[model samples]
Target: MLELGENPDTAYQKIKQLFVHLNLPERLWSLSPTTFSGGEKQRVNIARALSVDYPILLLDEPTSALDETNSKAVIQLLQERQAKGSALIGIFHDEHVKNQLCTRELTFGD
Candidate 1:
C-alpha cells in the first residue's frame, strides 16, 4: 500500500497513467503549493496515489476540492477501478458523490 501526501514528484506520472488511465498529467511544478487551487491540487493528489497501482485505495474526501465536472470524472474513475476488482473506499460529504458511488452508507455522529 502507498500513502501519498501532498506534493509528490512528477516521476510518479508514468505509473499513474498506467493504472488510472488518465490522459491529463498534472503540472505540479507550474504552481507553488500556495498558488495551487484546491481542484488542481486534488488532481495531483489523485495522480500520485494512482501511481502506486494498489489493489485497494482509501480516499478521504477525494472530491472535496473538485468542481462538479471533475467530481463526476473522479466518481467515474472510481467506478471503473471497482469494476476492475480494485477496492476503493471513498469518504465524502457530498450527497451526489455518495449516492452515485456508494452501495452502502455509514454515518458518524448525529
Candidate 2:
C-alpha cells in the first residue's frame, strides 16, 4: 500500500479487487496475512507486489500455490500489467502460464 504513493483510495480498491479475484474472504482484509493459509498468503504476496505501479516486475513461481482458476486470474492481471508497459521477468515452470505470458523465452542449462 505504501508503494502506491499519494493515492491510497486506488490502492484500497485494487487490494479489494485482488482479494476477490484471489478468492480471499473480505473478512480477512484487516487481519495479518500470517494467519492465512499457504495459498492465501501467496495470494496476498501477489496482490501486494502487483498493487504498486512499477515499471518492472519480477516474479518467481507466481502461481505455484494457486489452483487453476486463481492461476488464470493472476495471469490475466499480469497480462493487463504487461499491456500497460510493465516489463515482467519471471520464473514460471507451468508451461501453460509460460506460453500465455512470455513473449520471449530464455533457457539456461539442460
Candidate 3:
C-alpha cells in the first residue's frame, strides 16, 4: 500500500470489490492458490492483475477457462477497466469477449 502510494482503506475496498465480483471467498485468501481449481486460479489471476491501477493491461484468454456466468463476471471487470481509460490489449478466442473488450482486431491468414 505504502509502495503504491494508495491508502490502506481505499486499497482494501478495491480488493474487497474484486473479491465480490470475482466470487472469491475469505477462506481462500489464507490458502495458497496452487491448490485452486482452473477457474478459481483464473479469477485469482484476474484479481492480481486488477489489484494495481496500471494504465495498460495485457490480457490473454482471460475468460477462456470460465463458464458463461464467470465469464460474464470477468468481462464486467474488464469493461470497468476499459471504462477507466486503461489501454487493454489481448487475445480473446471467444467472439463475444473479443467484441466486448476490443475496439479493433487483426487476424493472420489461417
Candidate 4:
C-alpha cells in the first residue's frame, strides 16, 4: 500500500473493498495471511496486487485457487482495470477467463 503511494486510510479502504469483493472475512485482516487457508491466502494476495495502481499487470494463474464465484469476481475486476487502460499479461489455464480478458493471444513453446 505504501509502495503504491497510498496513505494508510486509502489503503485500508481499498483493501477492505477487495476483501469484500473476494469474500474474505474482516476478522482475518488483523492476522498474518500465512495462517489463512490456501484460497483465503490467495484472496489476500490478489487483494494486495489489485490494491495498487499499476499501468501494467503481470499475473500467473490468478484464479487457480479461487472457486467459480471468486474467479468471476476477479475477472470482473480485471476487466474493469482493462477498460481503464491497464495492460494485463497473464498466464491462465482457464480458457474461458483467458478469452474473456485477452484481446490478443500469444502462444509459447510447443
Q: Pick the candidate with the highest TM-score.
A: 4
Residue 65 of model 3 has an lDDT of: 89
The lDDT values for all models are 0.68, 0.88, 0.89, 0.88
> How many residue pairs clash in all the candidates, one count each?
0, 0, 0, 0
Winning model by lDDT: 3
Q: Give candidate 1's TM-score.
A: 0.68
Measured against the true structure, the TM-scores of the candidates, in listed sequence, are: 0.68, 0.90, 0.89, 0.92
Scored against the true structure, residue 77 in model 3 reaches a CA lDDT of 89
Candidate numbers sorted by lDDT from highest down: 3, 4, 2, 1
**Candidate 2, 1-110: lDDT as tens digits:** 75437477777787898889878898899998789888889889888888878899998999999999889888999999999999999998999999988999999889
lDDT digits (tens) for residues 1-110 of candidate 3 = 44779898988888888988998888887799999989999998898899998899999999988999899999998899899999898987889999989998988679
Cα deviation of 74 in candidate 3 (Å)?
0.8
Estimate the TM-score for candidate 2: 0.90
- Across 41-72, the per-residue lDDT of candidate 4 in tens digits comes to 88888887788778999989888988999899
- Model 2, residue 83: C-alpha shift (Å): 0.8
Between prediction 2 and prediction 3, the one with superior TM-score is 2
- Model 4 CA deviation exceeding 4 Å by range: none
Model 1: weakest 10-residue lDDT segment is 18-27
Off by over 4 Å in 1: 1-34
